[model samples]
Structure formats: structure tokens, C-alpha cells
Target: MIRPATREEYPHLVDIWLRASRQAHPFIDEACWRARADDMALRRLPACEVQVLEAGRRVIGFYAMHDDHLEALFVDPEVQSFGHGSGLMAHAMTGHSSITLWVYSRNVRAVSFYRRLGFSIVDEREDPETGEPESLMAWSR
Candidate 1:
């Protein structure tokens, strides 16, 4: 089940984000993700429309969106590869004619996953915060 995230669930969502971010972005320093956890919980997540994917009573995945831009999509590392990510993506796409997101160019798995979901690479640039090359991808209904 996917639903709007409650304020009480912010910590849990942050945990999922940290774990998944570390796993999927091995090329980046783990410390970077750790340093961003508090901001994710206190600022970033709240700034977006966040949704959580629950399995039974546990949150297994989530996506954060602002307008038509997808800011984040994460699945708990232990529960990944079981279609949770795709499910979250599908849910995020509903009611929007188009969506856009940025992904680290070195994160091949995520790049391929977005491609499979029909997102085309529209731009490429360096992320100033992380100094990492990233791609801008877009999908339209």
C-alpha cells in the first residue's frame, strides 16, 4: 500500500533513504549520505510530497516529489529487488502527465531502471554538492 507519509514516520523513511542511498551509490562516500540524513528528515522530505510504500505494517519504500520533479525514490536495502522500487515509481507517476528526476551517472542500476520505465536522458551536468556527474531524465504519459 502507498500513501502520504505521516510526520511520525519521518525517521523510518529516513532510515530507508540512508540504507538505499548507500547501497545504490557505492561510488559516492557513505559519509556524504550520513551527513545528509538529518536534512532529509528535517527539510528535504518535508519540502516534497512524500509517499511511503508499506508491506503489511512496515514501510519498504518511498518516493518524494515536488511539482513534476521526483526528488527521491528509495527502497530499503533488505527489501530491494522485489519490485518495490518499480511499484513506488508507478505510484508516483499516477495523475501526472510527465515527471523528471536526476540520477547520478555512476549509479548504473538506477539509470537502467529509469530507462526501463520509459525515462529518457534529457541533460547531463555535475552536481555541485557532490561534484558528481548526474543525468536529468524525463518520462511523459
Candidate 2:
């Protein structure tokens, strides 16, 4: 079932981010992980607005939406490739005509996932800070 997440979930969410450290480009240092965690932790999110993918009482994944844009999506590694990410995305799209997101070019898994969801690359540009290349993708309902 999908439901809202409580404040207590932040730590677990941070842990998930750590687990996904593999998402960073190859040859990247741990500083990138720390920076990601710091940024995500300090991010301002609307209260009670995070959507969680839960099974009974256990939270298996989470996603956040900022207006029509999907700001974040994370599924536990143990449950990845089991439709958790797709389910979260579909849930987020229910009320929106379209969604846009940025995927790091080196993150092959996410690029493929977004493509499979019918999100096409609308633009390609370098990330200003890290100078990493990224693709901007959009999906229209």
C-alpha cells in the first residue's frame, strides 16, 4: 500500500540514500555521498507529503513530488526490480498530466527505468557544480 511517511522516516530514508551510494558515477569519491546526504537532509519538503511504498506496516520504498515534478524516488535494494519503483512512479502520476526529472548520465539503471516509463530525454546538460553530465527527461500523460 502507498501512504504518507512520518518524520521518523528521515533516518531510514537517509540510510537508503547511503545504500544507493552505488548510484554515483564510477571513480567518484565518498565526498559525493556525503554531499548528497547533506543536501538531501537539509532539503525542505512539505510536511506529511512524502509517499511511502509500504507492505502492511513496513516501508519498502519512498517517493516525493514537488508540484508535477518527481523530486525523489528510492526503493530498498532488496526490493528493487520488483516493481516497487514503477508502482511509486505510477502513483505519483495519477493526478499529473506530466512529470519531469533529471537523471545523472552515469546512472544507467535510472536512465533505463525512466525510459521504460515513457520519459524521453528532453535535454542534456552538464551539472554546474560537479560538471557531471545529466539528462532531463519528461513524461506526458
Question: Per-candidate TM vs. native?
Answer: 0.97, 0.88
Candidate 1 — worst ten consecutive residues by lDDT sum? Answer: 88-97
RMSD of 1: 0.7
Alpha-carbon error at 124 in model 2, in Å? 1.2
Estimate the overall C-alpha local distance difference test score of candidate 2.
Answer: 0.79
lDDT by residue (1-141, candidate 2, tens digit) is 998877778778777756665554554566777777756756734432588888868788888777777777888777778898999999988868999888888888889999999999999999886788889999997
What is the per-residue lDDT of model 1 for residues 5-73, given as tens digits with 9 covering 90 to 100? 998999999998998888888888999999999999999999999999999899988999999999999
Prediction-by-prediction clash tally: 0, 0
Error of 2 at 93 (Å): 1.0
How many Å off is the CA of 3 in candidate 2? Answer: 0.7
Q: For candidate 1, what is the lDDT?
A: 0.93
TM-score of 1: 0.97
